[model samples]
Target: MSEEGLEYLFKVMVVGHSNAGKTSIIQRYTKDNFSADYKTTIGVDFFMKKIIWNEDADILLQLWDLGGQDRFTNLSRAYYQQAVGAIVVFDCTSEASLLHSKEWKADIDAKVTWNGKKIPTVLFANKIDLGAGSFMKDREIIEECCRECGFIGWFETSAKDNKGIDGGMMFLISKIMELGGHAAQGEAAPTNDSTITIRPRPKKVEADNKPCC
Candidate 1:
């Protein structure tokens, strides 16, 4: 909570089945680099990306990448306590992963809330590059599931190719900013690093993309 600029902090949880590309999405978005052999997150792993949403505010995005294994469910709950937003991902090529997307959302809905209501969640269908053909055929079903599961929106993503990574994250951050604004509500919570500045992000020419913060 710096007085010089409107620095806001938002905690967004990333949850899904193991190997569903949850960690890969975070890696791609935060580091702009992809690794094909990333180990599954143990219990939970964290990353931070600072974006200047607009000239009016700078957002320190605290991303929690939770382990997708059954044993970590209890541990994941502890980290979900104050999260204001969520990103539920699934492998577009895996039918079972798509079905479990709803389960992930439900799990967090019971653990946290934003302003006393359910958190704003977005869905990401990762590995879209590998399944582009089938993805289009099931587009309707995917969109329907997004609505049925209470996601504010959905996007096709490929962490390996760095496609739609920023779009989905930007969309979720936009919604969270709209819903929560910048309340000094939980400023006391310590972060791995403070004094974060909204450094410039790489050039993305897509007109649909949000301005880098």
Candidate 2:
């Protein structure tokens, strides 16, 4: 509530099922590197990034990475309160991960009181560098997911190649500024029409086509 709405601050949670590339997306955006052997985030880790809207004002965003393991599900609900935005990411290579996105959204929704208010949520189908044929036909699946779930923004990104990371962050920042409680009362929330073109990375073919079941 800095400067009585002169500037805005937002808490955004990056959440999804296990191994959905949530941590990798955060690391790629904040650090600009991909760790092949990265460890799963145990509890929660916080990362900060500043985004400027105009010449004089800037928005400070706190991005929270929540652990997605089954044991941590009960503990993750505490982090959802008063959250302004959420990036519900899913690995495009795993069709099941996208299905799990709906479940996670429901869990978060159950914790809140609904008065026809909408949270600025973005749905990202990550790991697109793996190619289209690798994952079950994804376009129809993801489009239906967004349409049914009322997600505000949608993007396809590859954390491995660091593509679409900046655009995704910018889209979220724009949304937070538009919806930050005050704007919601008098004005329309930001339009969820962001379009990011992802350039597929050159990936090596793997022999084992095993699903991460």
Model 2 agreement with the true structure over 40-91: per-residue lDDT tens digits: 8788887877665665455667788988774246767677655667888887
lDDT of 1 by residue, 1-213 (tens): 223346676788999999999988998888888888999888788899989776556778999998888424566667886687899999888878888888988887777765556788998888987865454575788888878878999888999888887988888887876655334433332233211112222332346667889
- In model 2, state the lDDT of residue 32: 82
The global C-alpha lDDT for each of the candidates, from Candidate 1 onward, is: 0.77, 0.69
List runs of model 1 lying over 4 Å from the truth.
Answer: 1-3, 70-72, 132-136, 182-213
User: How high a TM-score does candidate 1 get?
Assistant: 0.81
Each model's TM-score?
0.81, 0.76
TM-score attained by model 2? 0.76
Per-candidate clash tally: 1, 0
Error of 2 at 29 (Å): 1.2
User: Which residue pairs show backbone clashes in model 2?
Assistant: none
